[model samples]
Target: MTGPHPPRPGAGTPAGRPPVDGNAAAGLLGEVLAVEVTTAVAECRGCGAHAPLAQAVVEVDAAGALVRCRGCTRTLLTVLHVPGGVRLEVGCLAALTGAAPTGGAPGAGG
Candidate 1:
């Protein structure tokens, strides 16, 4: 679960026009991002300490992408990103964010 990202004030308020509620805490668009979690980032889910599980990798696609902790299997969000903006679906944060999956992998265009 994540906290609600409130929309900015006056985002849809226009002069001499009715304020649009579409930007009210939802229905907003922004740039995407990507992330690759190496196996060395294991941490304690209870104490947030790292010191367990040798190696495990997870690819995230957004600024706040969540993944299963290697030690406790708890959901952990990542803020890492690729060279360019993230372009993965926010729904499946655990999996790599990309256009689509081809041949059981990402970017393998068919």
Candidate 2:
């Protein structure tokens, strides 16, 4: 399942609100969220081996993230849950906001 990484649009939960529960979080399905990439694909700086891409799961504690690399099959850096991973950039955020980054909203093309 390879696709763009989802990003978090808002900061922490409400300023003065209780934390979200598992059921609440589960309800977020198909709600369209985002997360910047903590780490993207890269080759081993040492041996020049292909570093497989990975999906970093977001955590609530703000702790580092977890990535299961494909090539080395190893976990690399831990993310702080920011926006835009290595390959992605904030410029493309427009798409998530119902707009297009290239120009105006995407249009039919040949």
Candidate 3:
């Protein structure tokens, strides 16, 4: 049951690269997402932790934005502005639940 464990939080990224909250990615994600994604709930496939996307860890730069799970720091989603449009990569995101509009039932998307 015991083995070499993965690096702790803040260990996955390059040195001196400080991780920020998911809110930092709101602007980048806003380009494609219609809903308020920061308020949405994201499920981590790696750790099975369900938390608000706002709580997730994010790293953004000229390339794009990387979203990681808050509980286990697992890669959840990545968005990159490509040549023609945008390239979105889903990693350890098991599910994403966002609030529905008024009079609409909440639904889940993955």
Q: Quick one: best lDDT, which candidate?
A: 3
lDDT of 3 by residue, 27-80 (tens): 545433555588889999999999999999999998899999989988999999
Local error of candidate 1 at residue 26 (angstroms): 30
TM-score of 3: 0.62
Best by TM-score: 3
- Model 3 spans with C-alpha error above 4 angstroms: 1-33, 101-110
In candidate 1, position 81 carries an lDDT of: 56
lDDT (10s digit) by residue, model 2, range 3-107: 965645663454534445567554232232332222223344323444323332223354444433343444433345456533222211112221122234222
Candidate 1: where are CA atoms >4 Å away? 1-42, 45-54, 57-66, 78-84, 87-110
**Candidate 2 vs. truth: CA RMSD?**
17.7
Better of 1 and 3 by TM-score: 3
lDDT of every predicted structure (CA atoms): 0.39, 0.35, 0.79
By descending lDDT, how would the candidates be arranged? 3, 1, 2
Where does model 2 exceed 4 Å of error? 1-40, 55-62, 81-110
